[model samples]
Target chain A: QQQVRQSSQSLTVWEGETAILNCSYENSAFDYFPWYQQFPGEGPALLIAIRSVSDKKEDGRFTIFFNKREKNLSLHIKDSQPGDSATYFCAASGNNAGAKLTFGGGTRLTVRP
Target chain B: NSKVIQTPRYLVKGQGQKAKMRCIPEKGHPVVFWYQQNKNNEFKFLINFQNQEVLQQIDMTEKRFSAECPSNSPCSLEIQSSEAGDSALYLCASSPSGYEQYFGPGTRLTVL
Candidate 1:
């Protein structure tokens, strides 16, 4: 079974719009959630992360709205730009999680001009 | 620039041949991790080390795969015998603390 899941395989949004990507996890023990953005032929980079203590975490145009009780989270990219296009992965880890990340299938985002 | 560095941006090996990749984690980051990303876009955790001691590894890492992070030396992951299915991008990451890791550019391995 997949421990973490992303609803969409691909997403598209026009420039200046808000693009929302959804994610959910099965393990309730997961406390730390992080989102990574990957470009073609490059490794994933940490975009933003949220601990279970916070319901929401925002950074500039990127925001992560987390629902610990519901085991779900969503990444919102405000003012989505063409440069924002990439494959986004949602990952989770918890106490004694062995520092091994459980990554979602990923959502490919495309921002149109 | 990226702090985590991986050597040999690409490697090609025939089936049953040995393949090796190396990585240099960011300074002061004692924790190192290796992951295999296949063409299907799946990330498979391989192995990790704390300082020079291996902390954890998956089944795939237990068999044909062997990894070591020697003190004062760059970490390496070697596949004893390459398989067609072994073709993928190998990524190395490091973190000063757990949960907040950074990744390298990755080494693309192609098995024939």
Candidate 2:
């Protein structure tokens, strides 16, 4: 079974707008949630991450709002710019799983100028 | 910092031929992982190594694919007999704690 599921396959937002990408996971033991960004012909890079103990994490223009009860999380990119266009992947892992990440299908975000 | 690096960024081979890809992990990282991404946008776990020791691997990887990481040498994944189904971007990644892995530019393999 796919443990992590991303809701949107693609999203587009205008410059300076906010783009929200949603992700839901099935494993209850998953405590580490991280978001990765990938550009064309490049590997995915860490954009932001949040631990289960915290409800939210903010870094620069990226924010992750996590809900433990619902097992859901969303990445919000505020003041989106054209350079933010890329594919975003949400991944989850548990403590005992040796930190093997289960990644979602990924959502392609296009920040239009 | 010259993070992870994969050689032969693009590879193409005929069916039944062998294909090989190499990866050099970031300095100071102990754990390395390989993942295969299909055109359908699904990422499949291949195998992983920790300082030359094979930690874990999926069934698909163990059957036809073989990987090795010699001391002080770049890690390599080789296919005995490539098939059309093996066409995909193979990504190599390394992490210090396996929590957040840093990925290298994937090696795109095309089996014609």
Candidate 3:
């Protein structure tokens, strides 16, 4: 069974618009949720992360709105730019999760000019 | 600056040949993990280490793959006998705790 799932395989948005990518996890043990951004051949960089204690985390143009009770979360990219177009992955881990991350299939985002 | 470093951006090998990939985790990160991303399988967890100790590994890792974190050196994951099915991007990540892991660029392995 797929533990964590991201709904959209791809998304397109105009520059300066808001793009929302959704994610959900089946394991209630998940306590740490993070979003990573990857350009073509580069490594994935941590865009934002949130612990279960809080329902929201925002940094710059990226924001993560988490609903612990529902086991769902969404990444909101505000003022979406061409530079933000890439593969975004949602990952989850819990205490004693062994440091191995469970990742989603990923969402490919495109920002049109 | 990239904290986690993976060498050999690409590697191609013939079936039955062994392939090896290495990883250098960020400084002070005690845990390391290996993951595989395939077109057909998506992203899958393989195994992990904590200061040279094997913390957890999947059945696939136990069968044909071997991984180790030698003292004071970078960690490595090696395939004993390569198969076409083994072709995929191998990624390495590290974390201070078991929560947030930072991933490397990933080594793309192509088996003929």
Candidate 4:
């Protein structure tokens, strides 16, 4: 079974708009959630992360709103830029899950100028 | 730039041939993980290790898929007998505590 899931297959937004990507997970044990960004021909890079203890985190234009009760999370990129176009993957892990990660099917984000 | 490094960005092999890939984790990290990503963007967890000890792995043909992480040497994943189903991108990542892993550019494998 797919433990982690991404609700959107693709999302499009214009520059300067807020782009939101939603993700949900089935394993309740999941405590550590991370968002990775991948540009074509490159490996995925850590864009943002959130622990279960916190409900929200922000780094400049990027923010992660986490809902532990709902087992869902959302990544919000404010002031989106054309350069920000890439595929985003949501991943989950926990103490019981070990070092291995369960990843969600990625969301391809496109930003129009 | 990613601190992790993977060798041979692409590999093409005939069915039943041998295929190998290497990864060098970031300095000071003690944990490494391997994942297989198919064309449809599905990620399959392959194996993971802490230092020289393996922590977890999936059930595959033992004689076909083998992986190891040795001290002072780069980690390696080898397929003794390749199959068309093995055609995918292999990604390597490393972390200090396994909470967050840094990924390297994947090695695309094609089995004909």
Error of 1 at B13 (Å): 0.3
Residues B1-112, candidate 3: write the lDDT tens digits.
4589997789999999999999999998888999998864388889999889999999988888999998799999999999999989899988887667888999999999
Give the candidates in order of TM-score, highest first.
1, 4, 2, 3
A best-first ranking of the candidates according to their DockQ comes to 4, 3, 1, 2
Clashing pairs in 4: none
Runs off by more than 4 Å, candidate 1: none
* Worst ten in a row by lDDT for model 4 chain B: B55-64
State the RMSD for candidate 2: 1.3
Tell me which of candidates 1 and 3 scores higher on DockQ.
Answer: 3
The residue-by-residue lDDT of candidate 1 on B1-112, one tens digit each, is: 4599999999999999999999999999989999999997899999989999899999989999999999889999999999999999999999888678899999999999
Q: Which 10 consecutive positions of candidate 2 chain B have the poorest summed lDDT?
A: B1-10
lDDT of 2 by residue, B15-44 (tens): 999999999999888888898988776888
* Candidate 1 TM-score over all chains jointly: 0.98
Candidate 2: Cα lDDT at B73:
97
Q: How do the residues A1-113 of candidate 4 rate in per-residue lDDT, one tens digit apiece?
A: 87999999999999999999999999988889999999887889998899999999999999999999999999999999999999999999986434578899999999999
DockQ metric for all predictions: 0.62, 0.56, 0.64, 0.68
TM-scores, in order shown? 0.98, 0.96, 0.96, 0.97
- lDDT of model 1, residue A109: 99
Query: Clashing residue pairs in candidate 1, if any?
Result: none
Put down candidate 1 lDDT per residue, A1-113, tens digits, no spaces.
Answer: 99999999999999999999999999988989999999999999999999999999999999999998899999999999999999999999886534788899999999999
lDDT of 4 at B68: 95
- Fnat per predicted structure, each in turn: 0.48, 0.48, 0.65, 0.67
